[model samples]
Target: MTSPAPRDRVDELTVGSGARLEELVDRESLGQLATSFADLSGVGIRVFDAEGKLLADAAQPVELISYLSTLKHSRSAIESTVSSVKNLDPGPEGQAGIDGVSGGRYRVVALEHDGRRVGRLVIGPYFPPSLRDIPSQLLELEPALDLDRARQLLTMAPRVTDDSMDRLARHARAALDVVMFSGLRALLTGSMHLAAVRESYRELQSKQDKLQVAYDRLKELDRLKSNFLATVSHELRTPLTSIIGYSEMLLEGIAGEITGEQREFVTTIREKGEQLLTLIKGLLDLSKLESGTMSLRKATMEVAPLVRDVAQTMAPHAKKKGISLQAEVEAGLPALWADAERLRQVLLNLVENAIKFTSAAGSVKISARLSSLSTGGSADEGGLVLLGAQRTAVELRVADTGIGIPESERQRVFDAFYQVDSSSTREQGGTGLGLSIVKRLVEGHDGTVHVEANEPQGTAFVVAIPLKRATLRP
Candidate 1:
């Protein structure tokens, strides 16, 4: 089989490297150079690469060669002399050669780039002013040749002195060197731009891969966390129930009458046990919710009664802190489609959080109102429900005048066990699952809950539960 053609090499050169002049210059550009040089010098010019490939030619005067070809001997002599001129080697940089033709001479110059010889530029076939008669080469080849016609043809060729042709050739070479330098610059600049783009893409791909790996690791860790919570919470609940039961029995004098101090200790044990049990239950609930196993029992319920009950239950705790707690339900508000017990748990958590975070003499208010929701507008738009809009839902807002939640921590506080103040010296205390459980329970009712800055000072937890009954299913 024939060997595959060698891949065409790219002409792009690194800085300071030598390049083939033909590779740097194209046919059109060579033609332009030849035309411009010929015009400036009034001498025929031809260009060729090191490989002897003819790149361009301009202004060749054929009068003398065409006239000599009419006779056999003269034609042979002319052909031989022309071949000799073309075969003349461009010897050195800045060096011009004078090759004698049948009636004139040719001037040849070497083209160099980056201090290395790359090609040849031939400018000539011009008669020197000293020529007074036809050359012997033509005369000896055809003794019968017409001297008159031969001399006239010789005169017809471009006439220039040797020194003038050398100066013109130098100018042409300098012009071409400038063009080559510019061409190389453009090529290198474009290559660098492409390289930059490729590097940027590679860096972006690397970052995306790293992000994917990190995300996968986080998912695995989350799964492990859920599994641990489920196992440990289940193990703790059984023992905690016994602790609470035994402590309650002792406080009730089931083990015989106890001293007042002993009763107080037993009561503390029961309360602590209950508190620990509540924490374990919250963990269990969170695990179930994360694992998509938590279930809710939905029912249509009055918003006012539930809001009032939660506020009342949390009132004494608020009072102990010297913080006021109150509830306000808008008149004629409709019932909500929700799980009543879960909804009450949600309100209790919110009210308790508000009281716990509030300073002494602060206030916590639980208010509910009919709110019509649209895609773009708020719920209180004259209670007008547009087509495809949701009917009025009950918005239960628990607002507090407390040492308010920082805007940054408001969203994160609802994540399981995430505390706004996690440092050991924090003034407030509790397992941080209250808001997390509240968020999960509210979402289970097809409701939305969010926190915003309460006017002037403090935070508000707004819960919007739809009035329409949901199709409850697992």
Candidate 2:
């Protein structure tokens, strides 16, 4: 009683036990198959999927149907008959037929694939061999019916025996079975490939989640280690300072006169105590830097004066090692916006390291020059350049003619507690925290520092600090 749903709406229904006809073969292929069969059998054909969705139709135009459509009553009868035939079930035998009022007939045959019915084929509007005349029901249905024209058009329709029509329908279904088999194989292969890819993605996502958890745990452990170092260093500094002070007092006779051997022992005690205090201070500074809690008292300061001051502070140590120490500052260089004290510490660390490694008569030079940073080139090769727009910066180089660092080990020197000469009998002595602290301090000021091989020998530590205060990071 109800009209069939629109083709797109019917197509949206999921295929159940049987696959949909449309999925097995494309409409173009189905239409071609139907057209070929209709041409060979001399009977018009229409195909519909299980859900009554028309897949394709190949119908030879009939003048009788066209003339009937022009008359209101006859047109209604024709439409009702067509709808009934479309909704017709062929039954378990998979064959059924409906006779039209005009003495024409339609044969409906089930389309089966893989032992299940997927759709139906309609072999329609063909005159049966037994039909002798147009029925009176058609002639009386419309008052405007042209009797002579209807009779002539009915004769023109294809005439075929019932057995021949049935054979054609079976043959058409057989041809479609081949197409459906190939299509089903392709569909299954594609589905399996998609399933495999989805499984691989799920596995990758699971591993990524586990890695993220492990990385977070490591970060938390590192933070706790920094906290522990800060607390322990603070507690150790108080007693170590007292030891150094007492040793100085005993050597100076302020704690009473002492023998030469006692003085010698006291001096060693004072020196070792001072070294230990320096190490503790380095640890405290490192902890603060790592936790991003170190505050900078930044002000506009000249680079030349800062360079000269750092060289002067380290000059006595360089002279003590019999190394030539010099400071070269370019005049009229632009001022830098940074914490003067932190910058001094950075320069002092570099210069002291240079002097410590240099042999007797080797030279250690600290120089400051106006340099510009651009988005290219390596800093260690010469003046430092970074990946950014051009900006003015002050470049400081602490170059020494000492035991040269190998190219492979140069970069690792800036890592915390990393030493190039790490052997127990190495001549130079350091806790290896100095360069690490220097790197962090320079970066806090939004500056860059790197080490490169010195010309012909030793190592050069280059520091480039931008002149702009706004560029400095907290």
Candidate 3:
């Protein structure tokens, strides 16, 4: 049978340590339990894992400590990548992956009971009262890491003379006895998390299999839709062409005299037919894009002209709404590797949205700038984020003075058939699929889109895409 748990450090660390019976717990419990031991013996207690990982260091300050949070987050990722890499061998010894060292400082001791290694405990680099500041000799830490909080925390560590080193060790052993009880609780929590992840993974795998089945069915349905559209469009064009010819003949008096109402109705029918054809063509284009059947005619075309063209085409629409449109495409802007027609469509859509949303006297602006594309490979030096490599990024922004979307709903707006207002029969007339299609098309070119609130009022859509070619300065 295990020995009984001790009430005080003097009773605990002696030969009676074997009887300690509290369950091992984690940071929270360890923090509370440390206070109990601290209150009893007046020694500032700290605990770290076997690898010197700080399990509970109530002595530290959060604001003054930098990179610790990042290190903590990276811990899980490091563990995952390490585990994956270590599975190369089938031997039992190959399973040892987790690192045993905490990166910089602190000392650790194995917490054991009944000859079983439970966890670990750590004491710190806190200065003895004799010293004024943290010693630069121990760990190569930055001076800023040594703050007033560190000074305060260090003062609390139990002070002793060299002769009583063994007693200090015994006291540490007693402190660990209290900590082991809490560590057991932490171990149970970790086990529960592992089980939850396994269950979630199993569920995800099942859902993925269902998605595969659904996707196969969708492919068949898409094929049928394509065939139906092709047949109907061909039949439709033949009748439409004949109707146009007959209407022209009637207008030229080839047929007998008709009433004014009859002529007006015929004219309306002809106009509606033409609109229907346009809608049908849009459908065909959208389908081809979705099916990966649309062929791109790639060319190195100057961007300035395209920007001007889009602005010009949409200028009439803007004029009708009394909105001022601005185009700030730079002179001698480098040629972009793009399909001219499709790029035109992309710009046109953005310009149309800008015009549609803006009120009279409000302005819509189109601007472009060249920048480094990679957000990841940048370093922060002197409080500025600068890119390591000179890769090309073209920034295209459509800023409008109109109603802007809220931050919470920005991403949801990109979803197909999603709109800001979903009230029954609202004023806005749209399929709510334009932005969705726009997002997909841009992503295909390895680009990103984000919406920002336009100053005062309105939304600014930022599009960042990597340039096909770049010229680095010597």
lDDT scores in order: 0.79, 0.84, 0.59
* Runs of candidate 3 exceeding 4 Å displacement: 1-267, 375-390, 422-424, 470-474
Better of 1 and 2 by lDDT: 2
Candidate 2 ranges with C-alpha deviation above 4 Å:
1-19, 26-44, 57-61, 69-80, 92-95, 129-132, 136-145, 156-175, 178-182, 374-388, 469-474
| Candidate 1 lDDT, 1-474, residue by residue in tens | 232221212222253244466656767888998998778666788888766668898967668777778778877766776676677786744565664546567777788877776778877777777777787766776887888988887777777787777778788888788877887676556656666676799899999999999999999999999999999999999999999999988987899999999988888999889889888988998899888788887777788889878977887899899998888999977767678988998988899889988999989999998774443444446544343455466789999998888888878989887998899999888989988888888777667788999999998999887667452221
Better of 1 and 3 by TM-score: 1
Ranking 1 against 3 by lDDT, winner:
1
- Where is the poorest 10-residue window by lDDT in model 2? 8-17
RMSD of 2: 5.6
Residue 167 alpha-carbon offset, candidate 2, angstroms: 5.8
Tens digit of lDDT per residue, candidate 3, span 1-474? 433433332222233233332334546767775566445433344554433345554443222122322344334433443334223221232111122111212233455665654444443222234555444431233333434554554454454332343355466666666556446445445545565676799899999999999999999997887667656765677777777778766756689887898888778777777766655555555556666777778777767787788888888989999999888975555566667777777677677777776778889999887755654453435334443444576677889998778899888877756888878776655656567666766765666777889999998988766677543322
TM-score of each: 0.66, 0.83, 0.49
Candidate with top lDDT is 2
| Model 3: lDDT of residue 82 | 34
